[model samples]
Target: MVHFLPDILAFFFIAALIAQRLSVDLRLPDAAYQLITYILLITIGLKGGQAIANNASMALIGHSGLIITMGIVITLVALIIIQIFSKLNKADRVTLAAHYGSVSVGTFAVAVNYLEVSQIPYELTLNLFVALLELPAIILGLYLLSDKTHKLNVKTILAHKSLALIIIGMLIGALYGEISEPLVKNLKPMFGVMLALYLVHMGALAGAKISDIGSNKVFIVSFALIMPLIGASIALFCSWLIGLSHGGATLLAVLGASASYIAVPAVFEQAYPEANIAQALFASLAISFSVNVIWGIELYTQAALLISSL
Candidate 1:
């Protein structure tokens, strides 16, 4: 039973969903969600930084470039698909593409927990990849907006709290390596509990949005179900080309498959006020997130193992 505890934690998401259906008001305060988000971001950043400090080399730099390129490719493909297939307006197509293109820290956290419980050894440096994968999709999304007259505020996007916290944590971890070990050690143990708590909130939020899918329900549902598999396949191929371990490949697949519910939504809400933020969130958070949490993680791991064997 203990071996499956991490998997068991995922059930809280379902429980929260059920509670929401029953009109049980079990929502966490906004502040609590923010706090959990910060801790997870910083912890991931610190660990990745420590890994870099230990394994700093030109190869790592090269790999970082590849990861960034992967993110850009994912974003472009998402945009193209939305353009060709969906009947969503220009602004919404770009917006949804951005959400799909960006990575989700929450989903990444769940993948990390899954790897740990399975005793799968992935590169700790993948944490750095998480930070790397966050922005390119968003920048492209903003640029592709129909209103080109709207100046792109690069400075504001850079200063967004989520990205800033992760970067800050990474720098501290890399620079302070040994000195930061105690802090990392202390925070690491709390990861699982914190993640489970956060998922409950996510479940409730997703549950509330279940009936609020707005228009294009068929298209949105189809895209959410299918995009992750496509993303994961591409990522797995890249992982094999780059010589990643099974665990590393699995996590990379997760990163590729995740959609940015938090960062992308927040940025688009402010920057592209005309975009339908709730619709995008419903697809990313409600549908994509649920698919990844329930089945995608295990499936990706299996695919990674197969690739590694070949």
Candidate 2:
């Protein structure tokens, strides 16, 4: 697991750095980003839909809703901690909160890969949790940051690319039932390639922001490490309370721990234009993502196992 996973992530990361060093003008066009995002959202949605179709149950709905509430609690936890420790203003703190509260698809994919490679069984319906976890924290963070008189425009919220894709994919996947799987089969390989392209671009973007990250390195690094620990603690408790198996506990821990670089940032840049994009990008993409992908998964899994055993 470690051998190929590290190489795949490192290769794109190092490739981006190499591009930066060589002045090779490596950059992804906006079209490519949108296409990749759509593909990923749809893939998860279809998988989730497939899972639900095979085993539609009220209990699953309850579990999804409960896990989503956990997402909100996790968001607020991060926000409160950041407010106390960091000097950033309300907007920046909310921005950071929203990002940290949402799950990272890249990191989620890695965790799923780890479980698969290790032969541990996990809930495939957790993909639905991925869809569920995206919006609440972001909306809650925005509400917290908004003035008392300010009301969120629902239309505007629905129009966001990430939410739209998720909704569309979920609807098609759930409504269409067994038929969607065969149609999507041919498109699977392209998804991996697109993901690699996306990460490559992400690495390049991170490389470009190296100078910006240096100024707040200490604070960002600390938050990245510490926040996941807090999140995992919450997940460990909640998962045990809910009687989740080892794999379910780990995925929940990851959902609590992972941060969004892809979905919310697009909305954030538009919604909170005053917030520091560099800080959000640097913290989520560079710091938190690496921590979760590298060692946090194993750490959270072990912690969850220990907690569950007791």
Q: Against the true structure, whose TM-score is highest?
A: 1
Q: Relative to the unseen true structure, what is the C-alpha lDDT of residue 231 in candidate 1, on a scale of 0 to 100?
A: 82
Candidate 2 per-residue C-alpha lDDT over 6-46 given as tens digits, one digit per residue, 9 for 90 to 100 = 53644665577568657764668989877887787778778
CA lDDT scores, all candidates in order: 0.88, 0.76
Evaluated at residue 101, the lDDT of candidate 1 is: 86
Q: In each prediction, how many residue pairs overlap at the backbone (N, C-alpha, C within less than 3 A)?
A: 0, 0
Count backbone clashes in candidate 1.
0
Q: Residue 199, candidate 2: how far off, in angstroms?
A: 2.1
Q: Lowest summed lDDT over 10 consecutive residues: which window, candidate 1?
A: 1-10
- RMSD of each candidate relative to the true structure: 1.9, 2.8
